[model samples]
Target chain A: MKAVGFKKHLMLEEEESLFNFEQAIPEATGHDLLIKIEAIAVNPIDVSVRLNGTETYETPKVLGWDACGIVVAAGSEVSLFEEDDLVFYAGAFDRPGSNAEYQLVDERLVGHAPHGIDIAEIAAMPLTSLTAWESLFEKMRLELEEPSLNQDKTILIINGAGGVGSIATQLAHLAGLHVIATASRPETIAWTKGHGADQTINHRRSMPKQLHELGYENVDYILGLNDIDGHWKEIAEMIKPNGRIVSITRNEQPLDLGLLKSKSAEFMWEWMYTKSYYQLPEMITQHEILEKIAALLEQGRIKSTANQIIDGINAETLKAAHALIETNSSIGKIVLCK
Target chain B: MKAVGFKKHLMLEEEESLFNFEQAIPEATGHDLLIKIEAIAVNPIDVSVRLNGTETYETPKVLGWDACGIVVAAGSEVSLFEEDDLVFYAGAFDRPGSNAEYQLVDERLVGHAPHGIDIAEIAAMPLTSLTAWESLFEKMRLELEEPSLNQDKTILIINGAGGVGSIATQLAHLAGLHVIATASRPETIAWTKGHGADQTINHRRSMPKQLHELGYENVDYILGLNDIDGHWKEIAEMIKPNGRIVSITRNEQPLDLGLLKSKSAEFMWEWMYTKSYYQLPEMITQHEILEKIAALLEQGRIKSTANQIIDGINAETLKAAHALIETNSSIGKIVLCK
Candidate 1:
């Protein structure tokens, strides 16, 4: 099988940063499914994993998360999938990724792809949608209802034009929350607004003041997609008593949790790989969430967040996608198709 | 009305630490209920309010949270109670406390006292029980069912012989979780066992090793009554992936929240006063919880955790109770009764 991989962390401009290589197609066993990769999406995580490390690997590391594929074979223990079934998934962190012709994945983490969606669009929906869905519904425990209790409650999405934030804003709106999303640029601001943000605040300015001007003294929830340390003070100040905060961002410094103590707020981290990494009993929840996402997409309740598409699944195209994501200015997801 | 209060932050041994002062009785208004206090419980917060301050106040600040009393008057909007109702409550943090002969509290934060329990026992329950109940049921969001899905789950209660822990261990036990409680002293260890702790680990020791010795590597839930800053690293290390941690203890230092990212764990602060303090729409939940607590007490499903009692609700008695709490050596709760 042909795969896109890197033996060392290097600048994207370097020809060796990502290269085409031949690897054996792994066998499916113990609930694993052999998937033929059709389309893949590039996220900031792929860029960070590629560039943030300094040491060279003993073997090439294939780095991709979101993939739209078809199951070519299934393990004896796999009950959920079989040959020729279309699937989409954000694969596990410890395994060889889907930036390849074929990959092996746990059937429990794979979901049937939404019918009638383009390959690039279907590929873009898995990773970010899983993250946003789990963060809002599972981790933050937002209750969905006909007349949701979240109608009066507000949610502040930092960096609302980012991949997860784009989907989060839409899902939060569907959940009946008043959404205030942060976007510093004109195009991004308009993009977030289009994604169901009731209002937009600039992350470059004081979020609390912007929220105050928007008439919310404090938000009932905060979903941080950018830097958590940078926005820690603002999040603390803007969270209501007993509010929930879930972040996918990394904090370089220690967080002053005392800021949320008086309000008795909760803080949760949403790493999409946790269930897969831990082999948790709820790993199949990913399958459930993705199935729901597929329904939402097919029903037009949510549209694919794929903003840019590049041809081919080889090294050169992946390098270009990584370069775009590295800029951190991309409005939505970047998809690469074979 | 005579109140036991202090104008300055002083050691409990000081004569002026808790002095008798005369003040005009406050009238009930809005949702307020004027109650004649018959019993008061000394919690860690009372000691905190007395000792952790800088400048003296213009007037003495009364510091007591839990109380059992008779309602002498009700505000026009107070529909929950009327004159002559026997109630128990942990009043708001921003208002005058229960150390006075007459105190005003919101009717929503008060519960009808258990019919047959003594005032001292009832007073010892409200604050600690509320903290425990909220942390377990609300913060950790544990489902209530016997032989629950929690049967295979484990919980670690740090400082498991204190007021909240004594009740929390019993509650967690009743919820069908395997309880690993921390206690340093022999008496506390015995007390924790008596309260339904399945296993006891010393928080002063390497908690992870102790857990490993007991055939467990990580816990499914953790309830921290000890210092959060002190046990943070241990708690983070021993918490299973996607676990929940709820703490009633305040961390005086900044916390490294990044530790829980990979595991995607949850951290929540449990301040019993948050609902009433914010006048949140869910403030009535406290009244509902207390009513349940009273029923649980009546059914013998839970027991009062009052460990020591002072003879009178006066300055000297309050000073003794405060002194015991300040030492941090007291077991269970200390109450001062008329």
Candidate 2:
């Protein structure tokens, strides 16, 4: 099988940062499904892992998470899908990635791909959608089926132009919340509003003042997508009494939790890889969430978030996609197809 | 009205720390109830306000919260209680406290007192029980009525012999979780066991090792009652993946939230006065919770946690009760009666 990989972590401009290589196809065992990769997505996590590693791997480390593929074979213990079924997933952190011709994944983390969508669209939906869904429905405890009950609630999504924010804004709106998302640039603000944001604020400006201008004293929930270090103070100030906040961003310094003490608010972290990395009992919920995402796509309630699609899934194309993701201002997902 | 209050912050042994003073009685208005105090419970908050303040008040500042009393009057907007009804409550932080001969409190924060319990016991329950119930059922999202469904879960209560821990352990036990409470002294351990702890660990020791020796790697939930800065690292390490931790203790330093990131855990602050202080819409829930607490007392499902009772509500008795509460290891609530 042909794979795109790196032996040592390096910048994308380096000659050996990523290379084409040959590796033997892994066997499917113990609920694993062997899938032939058709399309893959480049995320900020892909860029992070490629540049952050300190040790050289004995074998090349393939780095990709979001992919749309077809099941070529299944382990004896597999029960979810049969061979030839198309699937989409954000694979586990510890295993081999999907930037290859074929990959083996746990059936519990895979979902049947939604039809009537392009390969790039399907590939872009899994990772970000899973993260957005889990952060809102699971961590923040939003009522998915009871959207009517959420009519009076408000959610503020920071960095509304990012991958997770794109989906989160849509899902929060679908849950009947009044969505308030933040974006600095005009294009990004328009992009966020197109997704589902009822109102948009600029991250570069005074968010609290802008929020007051929009007639909200405080929000019931906040979903932080990036720059938690910079936005945390505003988040604390904007949350209502007994409100909840969920963040996927890393903080450079310690957060002062005292600001929320008098409000009796809640804080939660949402790491999409936690369930699969720890093999938690609720890991199967990933499959369930992805299935729901597919249904939403099929119903046309949410459109795919893929904005830039590149041809081919080689070292060259992945490096290009990585460069785009590193720019930090990409409006939507960047997908790579084989 | 006669009140035991302090004009300046001072040590408990100081003559001016708590003194008998006279002030005009406050009239009830807008959902307020004027109650004549019968008994009051001395909590650490009373000690805190007495010693932690820097500025002197024109009039002495009263520093009491928990009380069992008879309503002497009601405001036009009051709907929950009638005159002459015996009620128990932890009044708002910004109002005149229950240390006075007569105090005004919001009708929403007051609960109909339960019979069959002594005045001292009833006075000791309102503040601590409200903190415990809000932390467990509301913040942690535990199933309150579905006890059988919670049988498989486990909770750890730090400082199990303290006011909140004593009631939290009992409530968690009644909710059907296996309760592991922490108490260092032999007497406190015995008291905790009697309260509802299935097992006890010493918070002063290596808690993770003790928990492991008790045949558990981690707990599903943790309620922090005191010394959060000292117990934070252990609390983070001993919490299970996707767990919830609630604390009433103030942290002197910032907490390392990164420790719970990969595990996707939740942290919540449980300030019992938040709703009333903020005049939140859910303030009425306190009345409902107290009514339920009264029923539980009537049904003999939970017991009052008063450990010591002192005679009289004068400055001398209040000073003595405050001295006991200032001790680092008071086992249960201490009440002062008139």
Candidate 3:
């Protein structure tokens, strides 16, 4: 099987940063689906993993999380998927990823691809959609089934034009929350508003002041998608009493949790890979969330967040995607397809 | 009106630490109830407030929270209670406290006192009960209405013989959860078992090892009532994936929140005064919770946690109660009554 991987951590400009390699296709075991990769998306995690490690790998580390693929074979214990099924998934972190011709993924993490979406669009939806869905419904404990109860509630999404933020804005809106999203650039602001943000604030400025200017004293919830340490104080100031905040970014410095004592606020971290890494009992909920997202996509209720697509799934294309993400100005997802 | 108060923060042995004083009885305003005090309880917060501040008031500041009293008058906007109603309440933090002949409290924060309980028993309840209730059902997000669903769930309560812990152990047991409480001394262990702990462990030792020895690797919920900084590592290690933890104690040092990142667990602060301090829209829920608590008390579903009572509502009695709390070995609660 052909794969794009690296033996050592290096800058994107280096010749060996990401290189083509060959390996034997792994056989499916219990609950595993052998996937033939069709399309893949690059996220910030990929860049972080690529550049932050120093140890050279014994084998080239294949790195990609989001993928649209066709199942070539299914393990004996697999019940959710079969051969020839078109699926999408954010593969596990500890295993070989989807930047390959052939990969094995747990059936519980795989979802049926939406019928009307292109492969690139399907690839973009899996990782971000699952993150958005779980952050809102599970971590924040929103009642998606009771939109009426959520009608008066509000949510602030920091970095509204980013991959997960774009989907989160849509899901929060669909759940009947008044959405306030933060975006600095004019184009990004417009993009966020188009995707279901009722109002947009500039993250480059004081978010609390921006929210106050928009006539909101505080919000019922906040979904933080970028720069957690930078926006944490504003988030603390802008959350209502007893409000909940969920963040995807890891903080480099220690957070002053004492600031939230009087408000009795809840803080949760949503790492999309947590379930698969811990082998949690509810790992199958990812498949359920993605199925709902796929249905929503087919129904035209939510659009794909794929903003850019490259021609081929190879070392050069992946390197280009990584560079674009490193610039920190990409509005949405960037996908690579074969 | 006769009251016990302090002009400055001082050690308990000081003559001026708590002294008898005279003041004009305050009149009730909007939503306020002027109550004639019957009994009051001393909690850790009282000691915290007394010893942590340097400001000396021109007029001595009264300090007490949990009380069972008679409504001498009601404000014009108050609808929940009228004059002559017997009530139990944990008064607002910013208001003049219950260490007086007369005090004014918002009706929403007061509950109808249980008919079958003594004044000292009812006084011991309000503050600790409210804290325990909010920490479990609200902050931990437990489904208290569906006891059967919670049968398989387990909750670990640290420092289980203290004021809030005693009540929390009972509430968690009543919710059908398997309760594991920590207590070092023989009397405290017996007290916790009598209060509804299914099992007891010694918090004086490594809690994770104790829990593993008791045939448990992780818990579904954790209510932290003691030193959070000391127990944080054990809490992080002993919480199940996606579990919830609520704590009342503020951490003296910054916590390494990254420890729970892979488990995707939740951490929340449960300050009993938060709703009233912030004047949240859901402040009326306190009234509702206490009303239910009153009914439960009448039905004998849960018993009052009052362990000792001192006769007379005066400076010397309050000083004795405060001294008992400062010892940090007192089980349940200490109350003073006229």
Candidate 4:
């Protein structure tokens, strides 16, 4: 099987930063499904994993999470998927990722690809959609089914034009929340507003002041997608009493949790990989969430977030995607396809 | 009206620490209830307020939260109670407290006193019961009515024989959760067991090791009532993936919140005064909770946690109660009555 991988953590300009490699296709076992990769999406995590470490790997480390694929084989114990089924997933964190011709993924993490969608669209939906779905519905515990109850509630999404943010804005809007999203650039602000944000604020300025100008004293929830330490103070100040805040970013410094004591606010981390990493009993909920996302996509209720699609799934194409993500100005997502 | 108050923050032994003073009885206004005090309880907050500040008031500052009294008057906007109604409450933090012959409280923060219970019993309950109930059902979001769903879940309560802990243990048990409480002494252990702990661990030792020895690697919920900084690491290690933890104690040092990131665990602050302090719209829920608590007490589903009672509601009795609380070894609660 042909794969794109890197043996050393190096800058994108380096010749060996990412290169073509060959490996034997792994066999399906346990609840695994052998997926033949068709399309892949690149995220900020891929760029971080590529350039942030110093250790050289014994084997080239494949770095991709979101993929659209077709099952080639199923494990003996698998019941959810079988050979020739079309699927999409954000693969597990500890295992070999989807930047390869052949990969093995748990059946519980795989979802049926939405019918009639482009491969790049299907590829871009899994990782960000699952993250957005879980952060809004599960971690923040919002009532998606009771939109009437949620109509009066509000949510502030920090970094509204980013990959996960784009999808989260749509989901939060679909759930009937008054969505306030932060975007610094005019294009990004327009992009976010197009994707369901009812209002946009500039993250480069004081978010609390911006929110106040828009007439909200505090929001019912906040989904933090970037620069957690930098925006934490504003988030704490802008959350209503008994509000919830969920973040996917790691803080460089310890947070002053005492700021939230009087408000009795809640803090939660949404890794998205937590279930698979811990082998939690509810790991199959990933499949359920992706299925719902697929239905929404197929019905055209939520549009795809793939802003840029490259021509091929190879070292050069992946390197270009990573380079784009490192610039931190890309709207929505960038995908690489066969 | 005669009240127990202090002009300066002083040691309990000081003559001026808590002295008898005279003041005009306050009239009720807008949701306020003017209550004639009968019994009062002392907590660690009273001692901290007495000895941890340097500010002196022109008029003596009164500091008592837990009280059982008879309502002498009601404000124009008050709908919950009327004149001569027996009530119990943990008054708002910013208001003049219950250490007086007459005090004013918001009707939303007051509960109808349980029938047939001792005045001291009812006085010991309001502060600790409200804290315990809000921590479990509101902050941790545990379902109290669904015992069948909660029967298999487990909750670990640290410092289980303290005022809040004793009530939390009883509430968790009544909700059908398997309760694991921590106590350091034989008397405290016995008290916790009597209050409804299914098992007991020594918090003076390593809580994780004690839990492991008792055959639980993790708990579904944790209610931290003691030193959070000292017990944070253990609590992080002993919480199940996606579990919820609520804490009342303020951490002296910044916590490494990154520890719970991978498990997707939730951290909540449960200040019993949050509703009143923030004047949240849900403030009336305190009245609803206490009404339910009154019914539970009337039916003997849960017992009062008062362990020691003093004779009178004067300065000397309040000083004695404060001294006992400062010892930190007194089991359950201490109340003073006229």
Winning candidate number (TM-score): 2
| lDDT of every predicted structure (CA atoms) | 0.91, 0.92, 0.93, 0.92
Clashing pairs in 1: none
The order of the candidates by DockQ, greatest first, is: 1, 2, 4, 3
> DockQ score of candidate 1?
0.90
Give the runs in model 1 whose Cα sits over 4 Å from its true position: A144-147, B145-147
Give the C-alpha miss distance for residue B73 in model 3, angstroms.
1.1
Quote the lDDT for B228 in model 3: 92
Error of 3 at A199 (Å): 1.6
Which candidate model has the greater DockQ, 2 or 3?
Answer: 2
iRMSD (1 decimal) for each model:
0.6, 0.7, 0.8, 0.6
DockQ values, each candidate: 0.90, 0.88, 0.83, 0.88
Writing each residue's lDDT as its tens digit, candidate 4 over A268-309 gives: 988888899999879999999989999999999899999999
What global local distance difference test value does model 3 have?
Answer: 0.93
Superposition error at A223 for model 4 (Å): 0.9
Which 10-residue window of candidate 2 chain A scores lowest in summed lDDT?
A249-258
Candidate 1: tens digits of C-alpha lDDT, residues A235-323: 99999999999999878999999888879999999999999999998999999999999999999999899999999999989988988
User: Residues B1-338, candidate 4, lDDT per residue (tens digit)?
Assistant: 99989999999889999999999999999999999999999998889888988898998999999999999998999998989999999989888899999999999999999999998899999989999999999888788778888998999999999999989999999999999999988899999999999999998898899898999989999999988999999999999989999999888898888889889999999888989999988889999888888888999999999999999899988888898998889899999988
